[model samples]
Target: MSRRRRKALPSEPVRCVIETLSHDGRGIARDNGKAQFVDGALPGETVMAKFTSTRSKFDELRAVEVLEADDARMTPPCDFADLCGGCSLQHMSGESQIRFKEDTLREHFAHFGGIEPDEWVAPMRSPALGYRRKARLGVKYVPARESVLVGFREKRNSFLTDIDRCVVLDPRIGDRITPLRELLHGMDAYRRIPQVEVACGDDSAAMIFRNMDPLSDSDRQSLIDFGQAHDLHIYLQPKGPDTVHRIWPETGEERLSYDMEEFDLTMKFHPMDFTQVNVDINRNMVHRAVEWLDIQPGERVLDLFCGLGNFTLPLARSAGQVVGVEGDDAMVVRGRENAELNGLSNVAFHGADLQADFTAQPWAAEGFDKILIDPPRSGAQEVCEYLTAFGAKRIVYVSCNPATLARDAGVMVRNGYRLVRAGVMDMFPHTTHVESMAMFERVDN
Candidate 1:
């Protein structure tokens, strides 16, 4: 059923001041026992919201009027702010977004986990706009509309929004939206194109177009010409991720790479490779995680879900030996290749499901002095338990979701690990999305 068509009991609109932002980018407002989550609102703002959906314990509302906007609020630079689903905190300034994330982490630590950091860690931030280097764009071919949509979903709707440009994406890729849409619309495979996977390196941009059918010769030529004209590296995926092939004019353009000077690392990645969207903030986060780990010259470290050795390779610079484990075999292979390319023979990578039983692995039994985890939103609950056997004295966790992190922290606490320090990293700016880093240490023997 369409979201708009879903039957929701209507309730009276209420005037309320948004107390704060929830971890999932919603604003919290309380009315008696029924909690209301107002979308498109900010903390400290007086607004009127009309309830659209209701439940026994909570209600979902949409802001109808801003009686008094928060001082920190500003007009979003993107014209598609309200319509496009790319960003949730566009109304809030970049700096304010960081502050909001910091507050959210602090609140979660105090209330949910019954923990607090002894000192305030600097909030990691990147450029306000044009920082997102990775994204999966939704593609919709509207026959009636005589157009192909290539952008994010509309706010609260599954339908793709018709966007000409995006300010949050790296300028090179952001400026190509219109061209991409027009190119697809003109192709014989127009309706067949369903997705555009974007990956940006420090100097190059790569996009993979997912198609339902093989492209015609003219279509292929047109795609190559378009890529050449725009100086973009293009790939085509006829089926699965492994089938993706470069379609650009130059063979050299097939490779997209990014440089991380802090770790002295440069990595070559395909368009579908997993990487942090915001490069600037990622550098800071990795540096901070390494510092918190307090890695020594000869300590052994384990990096969990260590995609492309983002943390593992950097840790190798300080640790005598580093082991990186990831669920994806392809990513694990890439990480190993990256380590070799960087001449870091101290790092080893294993392709295993961290969420699954790891008692059989020799690395799992081997003791590590420290551990770092950068898990997905699902959190690393299973891996947290696995670490107990590894005998790591300290652990640093980098999380994108606070609730999951808090839940994982609960597990660690039960297993004799105490959350010694935690703070927010504003990897994404002008969005309610919170990126946080935390350190947990086992109780002294």
Candidate 2:
């Protein structure tokens, strides 16, 4: 006789109270013998969830019903919250979101780094909505529907959502959604254009259409005329990010820039460049990081993963010497130019990949008294290691991902660094995205 196969365990639906939210917007719920991460649930409420995926220790759950609702859960401000995949925590109160993010950083510090801040960190909060300054709007022409949907992706799906407006986007772009949809509906290359890049500044807003095929002169003229009427700078991209160009009136090399009064800095960037979506949070973050670093006069400071001198120029105000290192050569060049434009002679920028081994760089030869690092979602693991090698007295780290930051902070702790303080910055409000900053110091021998 053939051996019989074991029976599969059946998943059971259970009601659990959501005590807190994870950084990625999942609700922390514990089930029988498993840690369940449930989506579409809020803290302080009981939810009926079905286990979707189970592991040995952790499980993923989909909220089937809200057995009890949290008072903190309010109606989402955005119309596309249920459909659009862009933001997850819009229904959660802004104050509650900030609190959750702060606790996230604190928990990371205590659990992974084996350290905690002596003083409570002041949370960095910004406008609750309409703060996104940079975004890529997805475009799709549904032949069956005889219309185009130009917005963000759908919830839990790769298909584009049918959106008339996006509340989290800047008012200029958010208000133009309907007109944009109509504009594309009448365009000859409507099917060819798959994306529209949005970049906004204090004085201007730009939209760049990414098309697979070249537009006719008449179509181009139509786009230009429409853009002029709407007071938008129109650009076209037939290929990669480098191919994006102004398709309308010729502006040779005019780039957009945002000014920070606290830093006394105005930095310029290209349309297809990396930038913080929220200008207000960016300013507050710079001020907070500078305060935490406490750059004294005649002190040597190092800024890692510095993009266009966001932190370097401000740091130069007090430090005798400030060096910025970035992976992008274009950004490094722009960083230098911004420093010169601001008349900051103390800051110097170098182009080097901080994600790799940057210890061999000549700039690493000079000892830095304090270090400021703002890394992308990948987090600055290698850069943190490099900084530890130099034995920098103080280290201030800014991270968009809490999990990776916790992992990197563990490395710092293992190397004799103590987590001094950490806080959350609400850079992207109405979303589950968490932006955080932490300060560390070498333990005294």
Candidate 3:
């Protein structure tokens, strides 16, 4: 039998009443009893949307025109806000954006975890603009435009956005996007250079160029000149992350350090190492985590997923002893060095993968009075089973993904923990990406 072809999408825009916002800030509406998700729209607004894709249950749409505006809506600060995927909620007011995140967290907890916190912590805030200190910026040399483009990818698309600069990045680098593009355009390895990882410390910034092919002498000279002009620590990675090496001013320390004055601690890290993007908020977050963890002077604590001892070293300053475990050997080695450098003799570091069966590990057998878990987006499902075995009195989880946190919270509650406090952190201020911290106490004990 001959198969019937699918119907083509409507050429003109269709009007819809936005009911609410989806998880990623898209507007949710109903049309012909099927759900329609409209992008670049707000709640309680009437918009004329164009369908981009369709599924069996819902249709994806892009709002081309707004027939009615919402109270929470505002003008976006970035010129490339509409096309850049770097930020999603830039159109909403900063205050409302944070409020939305709080609501989302509450919703996720209620829907997935089936419980709520006894106390809701206030949202942490800092300078929203130019707060990001690290990012992997994409590079593209479009022959059609006869120019190089560098920045984030296009919204809801894989293509790169034609942006001059980024407002979310630190002004030291955000304002230099076009200059970076120009510099790359003048190089012979521009096409081979797929990405530039930007990392900054308190006093310095570094850029690592991921080169697929070797750079010529002229290309190296041009990069040196660019580095001098911008005062940037330039490095080149010919292969994987391990092959990254300093190119310009190839001498002194190539490390970036951030200070947590409250804890009287300094964390030295490589540019390629994973560090929190917002420096001010990170320092504040560490302080909050330390306060919320409630580490006693004589208590033993376990720091899981401790990267470069960001939390392990700080937590050690207060606790009698802190044992850190991470999946990366390099990070574990770095953590031990950081502990030694900071003169935190009570802190110890171990390398172990927490995702799999880690019960055989040496630190896994020890009983911890308190615990701090900072797992990735997948959450700490495996470690949840061991909380009771370790006799943990209190637990603090630093989560970047709320859905995972909500799921893990359910696991912890079932294991005799009570959700005491929960709150959202404005790590990526204007973006829908949520970073949250929650505290759980062993109530049944």
For residues 1-445, could you state the per-residue lDDT of candidate 1 as single tens digits? Answer: 6466666566666897788777767778888756789888888888888877777788888887889888888888999887677888888777777777887777776676686655667777667889999999988898789889999998777999889999999988899899889988899988888899888988878788888998899998998888788778888899988898987855554567888788788887767888899988888888888999999889999898998898998899999999999999989988988898899999999998788878578876767899999899989888887778776889999999987888788788888887888888777777778889989888873
TM-score of 3: 0.97
lDDT of all the models against the reference?
A: 0.84, 0.84, 0.90
Model 1 residue 265 CA deviation (Å) reads 1.8
TM-score for every candidate vs. truth? 0.91, 0.90, 0.97
What local lDDT score does residue 294 receive in model 2, on the 0 to 100 scale?
84
What RMSD, rounded to one decimal, does every model reach? 3.1, 3.8, 1.7
Top TM-score: which candidate number?
A: 3
Which residue runs of candidate 1 sit more than 4 Å off their true CA positions?
1-20, 28-36, 48-59, 111-113, 249-254
Per-residue C-alpha lDDT of model 3 across residues 1-445, encoded as one tens digit per residue: 9899887887789998999888898889998899999889989999999988888899999888989999888989998887799998888888889988999999999998578999999999988899999999999999999988999998788899999989999988999998999999989987888899999988889999998988899999899999999999899999988899998887997787888888888889999999999988888888988998888889999999999999998899889889999999989888987887788899889987686776567766767889999999989888888667887889999999999999999999998899999999999988998899999999866
Q: Is candidate 2 or candidate 3 better by lDDT?
A: 3
Write down the lDDT that model 2 would get.
Answer: 0.84
Clashes of each: 0, 0, 0
